[model samples]
Target chain A: MNQYTAQQWRRYTIRVGIYVALLLMTAIFLIPVYVVIVTAFKNPAEINLASTWQLPTELYWQSFSEVMAEFGPRFGNSVQLVIGATILSSIMGSMNGYVLSKWEIPGHKFLFPLMLFGMFIPYQAILIPLFEFMRDIDLYGGIPGLILIHVVYGLPITTLIFRNFYVDIPDEMLEAAAIDGAGFWKLYTDIVFPLSIPGFVVVIIWQFTQIWNEFLFAVTMTSNDAQPITVGLAQLAGGEAVKWNLPMAGAIVAALPPLIVYIVLGRYFIRGLLAGSIKG
Target chain B: MKNNRDRSIAFLMLLPSLILLGIFVYFFIGRAIQSSMTDWGENPAQPPLSETVEISYVGLDNYVRLMTSFTESSFRVSLVNTFFFTIFFVAGCIMVGLFLAILLDQRVAGEGIFRTIFLFPMALSFVVTGTIWRWMLQPRGGVNILPTLIGLDPIDFAWVNSQETWFQFLWQDVPRILTFVGIGILLIMAVRYALNQRWRSMGFVAAAAIVGLLVFMAGAWDYIWPALDVPAAEPTIAPKGFNVALLGVIIAAVWQMSGYTMAMFIAGIRGVAEELREAARVDGASELGVYRYIILPQLNPIILSAMIILGHISLKIFDLVFAMAGPDNAKTIVPGILVYTKGFRANAFASASAVAVIMLFFVAIIIIPYLWTQLRSDDD
Candidate 1:
């Protein structure tokens, strides 16, 4: 009884320690969010070096109103860009994955990695050529161009996610369809596409967050009329006089949809991450 | 005979992705290489060219200029900055990640809350994180004042603007550093040799060490001479220690990414069978011992994958740096920003491409072998 009590005491101590450490790390992680929230809620006059961490004594909506006025239209561009990129890439990826994993062809194994390597290539390495290519193709300076780039670049990871997902599917399933004389399109539409709803969710959420948050390509590829929210937010922050309240408000506004998705559909996002990039 | 039809169809299915990647990825890589080898936008003699700009063969001149020119100290500084950032950024992520993963593995209360809070930063764009962190790290703002509330002087560390460095050296001492690093690597190999008792490989390592030492002592080797007269001047900028400004950027990046690594690790730790831990405990292994020995060895693959992912991200870090410190902020320069500044801003296309290629090679060094093994293992 004495030994058991000591063990319980040790376990309790360890548990408390773990909770304390976790709470501390979580507080550290949430500092930026907390700062953004408080600053966003404060009046412009209240936002200064001295009161950066202070709570708002009174509510202020002017910052949000101003930020929304600047970012409202640009947010549409982000939505359209993400939606278009997500749908197109998810479909392309599903097909590519089906063929790569299920429909083995000559050199398919070799070809898969060659294509998969694109996911790991830094966008900086491809920026200039991609810009020039977009210009030559007459897709530059528009959301369409950004959409195409995101989809094309997005294929590798989406394809990887779906391929890994499909790899688990018993071969007998594909064989059964084949034996039934379902042609390629029929096989995919009938079986593969139907079963790929989970994969679509994962890929769509992944692409949505990535394309929405993407700043480099958006800044370089699109110009004044077509700038995404990320570029707009940066420009807002970069104005001659630093308007902390406005940018803080815009940062929260910009982060809202993805934040909501991360909170709501976080499981799928985590699933995609594990199945996609960091897989070894 | 019937298999040929399905095979062709499979090939057809792969055609779209193949063609797209081929054009955008492979074809553009070739284009970048070609551009790097040519003087496209550097000709001051020509009127500013437009879409159909003509490029002349420069024969490695751009690379030479970047490597040797004193006018481009910023580029060299960016390289050193990236090196230091990659080391600290990756180390911080791994350590913090492993720590969080272990804590979460204890099955503590509010696991979902902790996981959600830890991961939500990753959902925010780098721009957002940068904006927040930039404010927080301000001289009199967020983080600096926390100490004052606790009865301490506001720690007035010059975070992003500190010109001072820790381990100052000279650029000309690169070969010395390389030789020292090589010797250190050789010592590690020797220790491994002692443990594995592999005499033949140890003999080979010794021979290679001797050859390496001989080359190091030679100081200059002209195995393939260019026969050009040596320039009277060399790069004059003295090397400095890792920039302290990058500490801010590293902190933000680790904050955004350590959660990702933690998630990966938590998954890994959960996948580790409970029986293994119980068996180790029964054998008198302490909890720390169980994690240090039994669990960690099994988690090697997770650790490796996390390292590679974090390493590549650090090597190509641009968005956070650009958003936090503006483009010309020399204290936190990195290769990705250099590529942008050179190519887009300065119209130094050739040198920009060269830098891009160099960055690509660094990532390739980390990724290729791991990928080759993954693909090969899948084949079985």
Candidate 2:
């Protein structure tokens, strides 16, 4: 699309030049992806010395398969945490958002701040309290305990996003639903929830990546079979039973769910982040 | 429409998070307040499951121990080392990060390649970064080899010396701190540089190089290449409290995070209004002057936000220390690790909970101001 008169174009090639620069600029963002991918594919000898830029000529299956078999349970642990947290967070986040946005409840502003406090509080500050709470209830080192930890950390932003989005809907819609004798469940699942899918997706992606990659709670809440992959990945020391090739393969395999999400929803990730940050 | 249901619905909606946050975050903090009042680490003879637990109510005992005994131990020395570690680490990252971001922002030749080169740090998990950096920063690694290639003697940095102490003094047994503060300064500078794009375009490479030479010559690199990244101590049972090397751990953590902060700053800069820059120019201000007067003031919010986020990140750093300290090195102590140590290794569940609760309190104090601004700043 260099459609321009030569005389006119010569006078201002700056815009044309800038676009070319941008094409190259875009590649910078993509380089890490390339590096990680290439690292995952290369055989051991070729790993450090091979042109890190070039694609593999032959797909290395052993590393990939070995990592999978070794790390499959670890991933399962992580997935278990992610799945449990996602359902709880989305529902709780949605309900809180809808109620806050639609209702004129007492002390909403003050309560909002109290809720908002959760987002800014660092994970370190809560670990002890969470540890004690989990241990007290005898839920420590299990899926249920981990789910509570995940949801506790997750609520603030998810709640904030859904609240921000719900503000867009008409008060009349909520009022009319109530007038029509719709109860909370009927009103929510039917009226409010459907309208918030895009907002829901945004929260889902944020929560999903967070729980998927989260190491702190994963390491703390569980130690054995219940240990999440993030913990499992960190424990790779290449002992007698441990093969680094498998770990590398496992790391690659472990990285896929989010990596795939990044590839597919790359645009959405940026967009959703922009929406959150710009408003945030 | 009638709505007594509003309050109930609101409470119900808020129920799940409140219960969790209250139990885990708030109520558990109350528990920490209670636990910290007692001595959980003592009375080891009392079985873990004993109902009439013999833990004495040693009021402010841990705080006293934290200030005196714990701080006197290698772990506390490690904590102080973290303080020292953070200063330099934050500086190095900001310097290089701001430099790279601006260089990339200028739209230079092979900019994509360089930008990615800069960002390669972010994709890696801290565990991986720690591993790679260990290879690079180790005295025996390729880094010192570069110096030797240029006719310099091979520097035997303490980083590879398994028994080397980080600090040495002849004074009355003041605890010796072991931290990688020297490299920490460099890393912090790099991060600052990454966050500030204009600094990057200015590419005071000659200045940076001089600084690097000066720093390396000034014994900054000495502490960074510690004597014991691996274990020389016989692998034995994981000990109770205070074995961690906190200083070295915090430094490695700061190195890993500073680059990420740069990306955030870039995002912040993009958020600034371009029209204001044009207006400043129209007012006959020089580019740098315009930036000094207009750009920096606009960037205050982002800078504050970055500091807050970084502070929080710093407090919870476990990955870098864990990787660097190895199994037998008693230097990777933080509340997070302490909790893991207590619950999983020692099976002292109540004590671990207390540590988690205490750490959470510390986190809240740092986070509150930032949260206040975050919630209200949008309206402004």
Candidate 3:
């Protein structure tokens, strides 16, 4: 009975230790988020009066309202841009990946790595030429241009994700589908596309976060009217004297879509990460 | 005929990525290289469209100037900063990530909550991270003032603006020191491999050490010193050092990435059968020993993949640096910003392309091996 009590005590101590460590880590991780949250809810005057760590006396909607008034239309633009880019890129990547995995042409073995290496090309290296090229092509300063850029860049990782996913599916399934008189697009529409919801989730979430949060291409390619929320938020914060409350509100507003996606579909997001990194 | 039809279908399917990637990625890269060979944009006042503009070939002058000429010190400074940043940032991510993964792997309570909190940063933009960290690390603000609630004096840290440096040294010494560090690591790894009875792997490393020694003696690195264009402006030997101000940036990056590495590690750890660990424990191995000896060996591939990912991110780090320090801050300057500044602000297209090429080399060094291994592994 005494020995049993000692074992129970040890287990209790270990649990307590883990809780302490986890709580401390969680606090560290949450502090920036907390600061952003609290600052966003405070009015400008209250922001000046309170320490950054302190909660607002009362939740004020002024900053949020002001940010909405300024960037509301652009917020819509971000949504359209993200949704359009995500769907287009995910589908393109799915096709590329499916072919790369299941079907092979003469030069595919060479073409595969060439496509994948594009992921590692620093966008800055090609900035000048890309800008000139986009302007030349008449896609430089609009949502369509931004969408095109995202889809192109998003190809590498998305293709990689879907290719790795399809590689794991049993060949017997594809063989059975072929036996049923399915053609190329027919096979995809009936067998692969229907079963690709997981791939869609992974690629969509991946592209959503990437396209939504991307700054360089957005900043360089788009002008004031066409700017994404990232650039808009930076402009909001870049004034002579920064009004902490408003920009914080703008930051949260811009961040909300991805944050919501992550929280709701976090399991799929983690699976995407695992598939991308470990499988590579 | 059926095989040919299927092949045609596959080729047609690949044509979109092919056509697009060709134009944007490959064609543009070729354009950048070609433009880099000329002085098309060098005359900032005369736009390329201007009637009198003379865009002429400059041969390898831009590359030579950026490398050998010390008149443009910013390029060298950014290169050095990138080196230090990559080293520290990758190391920090791996260590913290592995620690968290191990801890969270203990079946802690509220695991889901902790995991979500940790991983959410990966989803946020560098713009947000930079904005928040800039505020938090300000001299009288968030992190520094946290102590005042406990009646302690507020810590005054000039986080993004400080000019202090550590381990200050001449740039000329870098190659020698790097060789030593390289050989040292290889020696340790060789010893480890030897102990594990991996004789062939140990022999390869031993050969590398000998080659490193021979290179060190040959003085080939002497030609690497940047040319002195002017005599009186700065230190004679071209000093290089780590800027303390980048701590905040590193902290923000690590915070964003540790969770990613943690997730990878946790997956790896989960793949290890529980019976293996329990058996180790039953054999009188301590928990630490189980982790160090049994678990880590199994997680090697995961660790390497994490490092490569982190390294790639580090090389292309621009948004965070720009948002945090702005483009003008010399201390936090890196090659990404250098490419932008040289191309746009200075209208030195050739110099920008050279920087881009160098950046590509860094990335290729990390990625080519990865692709090779992955493709080779698939064949088995």
Candidate 4:
């Protein structure tokens, strides 16, 4: 009886230990969020070295207004960019994935790997030529041009996720459809497309977050007028900033769209992330 | 005829993406390689951005200069920074991720809320992460002042702007250091092969290690790669290694990405059959033993996948450093920033492309093998 009681006590200790460690890690992870929130709410006068850990005396919401006023146009640009890029890439990826996984087009064995390789290369490797090519085609320095770049670069991962997603739909389902007089387009539109809502959700969220957060291309490819929120936030936060409250506010503003998507559709977002790396 | 027509339609549907990817990925890479071998900006007569610039080819000179020249020491420093950053960032993410996954696997309550808090950072932009961390890691303020709540003095470590370096080594001795590293890897491989009783593979690895050791001992690297020789214009030695300022950026990166690995590892852990674990437990294995021996072994592939993903991301890191340290901060400059500053700021197109190609080479070294194996395994 004493031995059993001792074992129970040991197990209880371990369980408590696990919770303590988890809570400590949780606190560590949330530190930046805490800092960002408190600092964003504080008046500029209250934001200093010594008082950083202290709560604000009262809520100061002026920084958000100022940041919103300055960042209004860039926020619109990011929305337009993400919407256009996400829709185009998701549809194209669905089509390409359906064709590659279902139809088995010739040279797909070669072509699939070739396309997948595009996603892994550093964009820096192709940035110079892309800039020149964009200029040559008269598409540089605008939201539309940025949209095209995102869509093209986005094809590899979007297609990869969708392809891996589609692989589980059972080839027999497509084969049965084909026997029932479903042509390529007919099969995709009637069967595959109807069943692809989950895939679409995953791809859209992933691409939306990626295109929205991207900075290097946005900074390089866009002119001042077409800058996204990320580049705008960088500019606002960059330099010897006299003010800290504004950038913190701007970061919260910029991070909201993707954060919302992730919170709402977190399961699918994780699916997209895992699909990009681990094979089905 | 219907089948053939359906095949044609399928091919046609994919044709547009194929063309776009061809131009955007393959053809542009070729163009970058071609431009890297040119004197577009190097020559005074051939300006980089001019519409009708006269271009002349200067094969590999830009690469040679980047590798050896004293004036281009920043490029070397950036490369070293990338090396150390990739190592720590990848290691930090994997360790933190495995820890979180192991904790969450314990059937804890409120797992969803804890997970959401841990992973919310992944949704935010690196620019946002960089901005927030910059404030949080302020020399006197955010994290430094936390200890004061417990009656301790405020910490004063310079987070983003530290100029201190660690593990410093001379640039001139890089070849020798690399050779020794290569031999070390080979020797380790030989030991593994020998343990498996694969004598042929062991012999090959052992021979390679011996050859590497001999080459290092004989000091023949300068002859093999003339770029290792010190240039005549600047005879002074330059030191390069890990910079202290990058720790803040690395910490921020790990914070944002560790959740990603956690998600991957959770999936991997759940995929491990409950019966296997139960059997191990029934055999009188402790919980730690089950994890150390049974579970961790099954997670090897997931760990590799995470490392590859994190490794490539670290190799091309730009925005976080750019936001935290600014582009002009020499202590935290990476090759990605160098490409931007050189091409966009200095109009040194050839040199920028050269640095970019080198970055591509490093990424390709890690990515190609992983992709090959992944695709090959999928074929089964």
For model 2 chain A, the run of ten residues with the poorest summed lDDT: A237-246
Best by lDDT: 4
Tens-digit per-residue lDDT, A77-156, candidate 3: 88888999999999999999889888856677778888888887888767878888888889989999999999998898
Ordered from best to worst TM-score, the candidate numbers read 4, 1, 3, 2
Better model by DockQ, 2 or 3?
3
If the candidates were sorted by their DockQ against the true structure, best first, what order would they fall in? 4, 1, 3, 2
Residue-by-residue lDDT tens digits, candidate 4, B67-111: 877678788889899989999999999999999999999999999
TM-score of chain A of 3: 0.94
* Candidate 2: stretches off by over 4 Å: A1-60, A120-138, A168-191, A238-246, A267-279, B70-72, B92-260, B347-358, B377-380
Q: 2 or 4, which is superior by TM-score?
A: 4
Candidate 4's displacement at residue B108, Å, is 0.5
What is the lDDT for A52 in model 1? Answer: 80
User: Taking the tens digit of each residue's C-alpha lDDT, what string does model 2 give over A78-130?
Assistant: 88889999888888888888877777667677677687667655465456556
Model 4 in CAPRI terms: which quality? medium
Interface RMSD of 3: 2.0
Q: What is model 3's DockQ versus the real complex?
A: 0.64
DockQ of each: 0.68, 0.30, 0.64, 0.79
